[model samples]
Target: MVADKSPKAGVQSVERTFELLEIIASVGGSAALGVLAEHSDLPLPTIHRLLRTLSAMGYVRQLPNKHYALGPKLIRLGESAARLIGSWSQQHLRELVERTGESANMAVMDSDMAVYVAQVPSPHSMRMFTEVGRRVHLHSTGVGKALLMQLPNDAISALVSRTGLPAATENTLTTPDALLRDIDLSRGRGYAVDEGEQEIGVRCFAVPVPDAPTLTAISISGPAARVTLKSATKVAPLLKRIAREVASEFDEHAAG
Candidate 1:
């Protein structure tokens, strides 16, 4: 018998390399060769060769435990990608602000927190504003809940265990059970709400960006006086629509 090699072997090799990288990222950015091979369904020798090439290119590193991990070079690439994603979503956020008469925000899940990536403030004088790059606990904010609810229940449990649900305001959910209930509600209703949870008298409505390459959400927030529960009913649809638009933009960019 002769070993068979396909014409598209080079393309397959490239795809397998990216699959390994994605597996490492999914496993918190580090895993042993056996683990990578198990997840990738590729031969151990092939995985080793790819890892060696990736390591030489500074895209992966061998840790003390002999596990391959995402390398520091990925940090620069990730930051640049994040910035571009944020920039691309700004117009959609601005549209959200215009439609809802509230501040609109885009956020992505980073570890155990939700990091604000972009914002478009309401034209009103009394609008809400969260600084770009501000990281907030995932258990309390609207965007946080929106991103969290997209994960599996076990992953959600693990994350909540790591980052305990601390009270951001008196109305914040301070227990895992309560937060989980809210997550369920968000998943059921197609959106999440922060009713004075992150800040007293501030309300927010958030929807996850569907089909996004990463865990991302878009939200609209303002004072309770203006952004009431009724306002949430009105804004949720807009948020969801805009989120889908943002996700489509992401898909297009990824394809390009």
Candidate 2:
């Protein structure tokens, strides 16, 4: 399908505003309003008005130097969008939650941590706890391992050097060699399993979110009583299928 053309009615203002944001992003961070106006081919008055409106809406930020950049609202909006698309994984996560009665989540690597972009909560009284922006170390979580498998050995080594294998729990991998071995095993198995690594008694089964430019992963998690090796064996294929579907959705969205 053809993508929607920009500057639709009533959103011409938004289009112009994003145009300025594009200019700033193109400049590799921030830009003066005059340069933005020139780049967007809009009049100074119009650019100022659109920018003012965007700033008020929190989509554009004004730096101390009077330059404009994308704001926190962009992250908020992107998260909202991620959730919408993440709903594709919801059917699977919900099923996993229902079958295992545990919390299920889909996360992506953002710098050094795994951020929960989407989640399906268990209805049980004792459930795994997590939120959208919840970030956890790469070496300590199942979702992190799933995503880390996508990186090359050299890159993984670099990340290990940068983050250091800090143990979240006694069960957590505290050495680069151990973590590397786990990553390799996860890649070989086409899934990653966390056994009381991130938290005591919490187990997770994870698969990589495919078709992304960078690493992204999703997992179903719960207490060890419910999310055992046998349970993960049952859920692995399902999680991989859902992750692939979500990845395709993301690919299409990015292409559009």
TM-score of every candidate relative to the true structure: 0.86, 0.68
Poorly placed runs, candidate 1 (over 4 Å):
1-10
The number of residue pairs in model 1 that clash at the backbone is 0
The positional error of residue 159 in candidate 1, measured at the CA in angstroms, is 2.2
Write model 2 residue lDDT over 157-243, tens digit each, in one string: 877877788887899999888889999999998999888998999998888877774467878888888778887667888888777
Supply the TM-score for candidate 1.
Answer: 0.86
Tens digit of per-residue lDDT, candidate 1, span 130-161: 99889999889999999987998888887777
Worst 10 residues of 1 by lDDT: 2-11
Runs with alpha carbons beyond 4 Å of true place in candidate 2 = 1-81, 251-256
